[model samples]
Target: MFRRTFWFTAGAAAGVWATTKVNRKLKQLTPESLAATAANKAIDAGHRLKDFAVDVRDGMAQREAELGDALGLNDQDAPELPPQRRIAAIENRTYPKYTYNRNEDH
Candidate 1:
């Protein structure tokens, strides 16, 4: 029984030492793996940027068509007034007011 217990303790110590050595090696190898991962991420970002640019161009074209219809202007016609100026020309303009101010006393 004593012999068996001694062997079991020794085996557990050896396993712990082997795991520590393997973990050290893995830590040493990780920086190169991280750099390669970053390079792959940059390549993916470039593809995403290209896709986003195309989406923005298509969205702008659709928005311009909708705005032209709403304002009774032809698609080819440039409006005499800018959008912000047109909004300001409308009646019953009221600025937003806060009901409560945290810093002010009631």
Candidate 2:
């Protein structure tokens, strides 16, 4: 009789726990809840990405400074390349005249 009572109590507790879990899941599955959850996650991811980018920029600047100091480049003026090697965005390029006929009907 005592063993039977113990088993009955345990089963009732399990049922209550399962029902609570299901209800919580159903609530989360609702459209509004899902959207809010997704938006929150997206905002969190955006913040993480922004942080990562800032860290990368900071590290890059630090590395550049270290390299410049090691190479004694900080004290000198930047060198200028010869005119032939320089390219300007406003410069126009000339393309070679071309002709191609790959069609057998040509």
For each candidate, the alpha-carbon lDDT, in order, equals 0.88, 0.95
Instruction: Write the residue-wise lDDT of candidate 1 on 1-106 in tens digits.
Output: 9999999999999999999999988875798877887889999999999999999999999999889889877745674775564345667889898698777875
Model 1: colliding residue pairs: none
Give the poorly placed runs of model 2, Cα more than 4 Å off. 77-106
Backbone clash count for every predicted candidate, in the order shown:
0, 0
lDDT of 2 by residue, 1-106 (tens): 9999999999999999999999999999999999999999999999999999999999999999999999999879989876786666865878798777678555
List ranges where model 1 is wrong by over 4 Å: 1-31, 75-106
The alpha-carbon lDDT assigned to residue 92 of candidate 1 equals 89
Q: What is the TM-score of each candidate against the true structure?
A: 0.42, 0.66
The window of 10 residues in a row where model 1 has the poorest summed lDDT is: 79-88
Instruction: Tell me how far candidate 2 lies from the true structure as C-alpha RMSD in angstroms.
Output: 6.3
